[model samples]
Target: MSTEQIPEGVRLAPAMVAGARIYIPEPTWCDVDHASENASCVQDVDHRTAPAYLNRPGSDIESLLHVEGFAELSGAHADPVVMLNDATAMHPAQALRWAKDVVAFAEKVETIARSVMPELEA
Candidate 1:
């Protein structure tokens, strides 16, 4: 760890990367257990939220999502993104639009469900 003073409002933590100690900016949303010996914190790498599982009403199928935020350090992209499992990444605005569309689709599904099962109207 460097003796350099950490700036106010900024948090830096030391991590071992490739067998060398380095400092990395820690984000508030980062839930990584840095105390663990296996912790890996690399600069320019993304800090991500805990995986959230999304499941259908009555199915074994499910999906996972995570919101990842990156720092501008090392010339890496600083934009925050929503990642679907390991396949897709979307900008915050795109994620919001997609969420709105999902809401609308869910409403349509609810309407169809109610029509088919009038008991659901209760």
Candidate 2:
């Protein structure tokens, strides 16, 4: 075990989103498609709205850019409703695939910590 891995005393914590320490989730917004799906009385209505106003735009890590992430990775236009439905249906199988993903992600994190902040490896 690395000696530096042990904490010697109290230290200030990392910066966090404002008000997040209270444990309340931030107010969320949905695209028109999601909003209509939740707010509508019809269960089988097709969501055929323009893509411009349908989903939040940006990178996934920057925010929860649902269909945007898929579209970016896939280099194609996205259908927000169908993509979300697929995600929900596939979530269990998707989570099971983490058996391989977690090892790589954890190793990369530890490698960067040991390289950039050697004190953390002590």
Candidate 3:
């Protein structure tokens, strides 16, 4: 038999917050008919995660993930894109917000990586 590790080189650290639910903060929703059918395919996470980890004041992605929301959400679910659109329809503001969030998040991550891996300068 084979066993799999959680993949974190570092053990679970205290005071470390997981932002799994922030990316998709809207609650488990139903289709227009208000049915839970479409939601079945989506995995439901603990409700506590959103309130505790998500829900930040910053309008940008860093504000959205200043505490590591991006990492957790990506790690937690596999098909968030499909799930997000399928879960519930988003308005224009949602689209705009997401775009801004992603751009800001990418810039910050790139900056951090460049700092850590100075070889990027080459």
Candidate 4:
């Protein structure tokens, strides 16, 4: 994708990290799209606050654009009406297909990252 092709209401910036930290995830709400048979959600819903580990260089790196599907919910604000546990019902065949999708997505993220941060590539 070209710079001009980025989503309209999106912004990107660079920042320097100082130390290790953890972040709490914000709740995400989505409605089921009947036409596509998928959830209508936002991006970065599955991304970790800290994308890399500074303490251990080259540690098991994750895709910057990580994607995850919701399975269960807990806590005071948990909604029994919305949360689904269908992920538990995934068959071995489905798991394999999902794994292949994740691999493809990671490759796309790597390509985009390289295009934007060519200097950071080793």
lDDT tens readout by residue for model 3, 1-122: 11253342222221212422122322232111112223322233212112112334553333332221111222443222212322332343565687688789879988999999989863
lDDT of 1 at 1: 36
**lDDT leader:** 1
Query: Residue 112, candidate 3: how far off, in angstroms?
Result: 1.3
For residues 1-122, write the lDDT of model 2, one tens digit per residue.
Answer: 23355344312222222222211111122222332233222222222223212233564334332221122102232222224322442233463474357568868978988999788844
Clashes of each: 0, 4, 0, 0
Whole-model lDDT, candidate 3? 0.34
lDDT of 1 by residue, 25-110 (tens): 66666655443433333543445667666665565565433334333334434555677665577777887898898789879988
By TM-score, who's the top model here?
1
Error of 4 at 70 (Å): 16
Candidate 3: Cα lDDT at 52: 14
lDDT of each: 0.60, 0.33, 0.34, 0.37
Model 1 misplaced regions, further than 4 Å: 1-10, 19-22, 37-45, 56-61, 64-78
The residue ranges of model 2 lying beyond 4 angstroms of the native Cα positions read: 1-38, 44-61, 64-91
Distance from true location, Cα of 89 in model 2, Å: 6.5
- Candidate 3 differs from the real structure by a C-alpha RMSD in angstroms, to one decimal, of 15.9
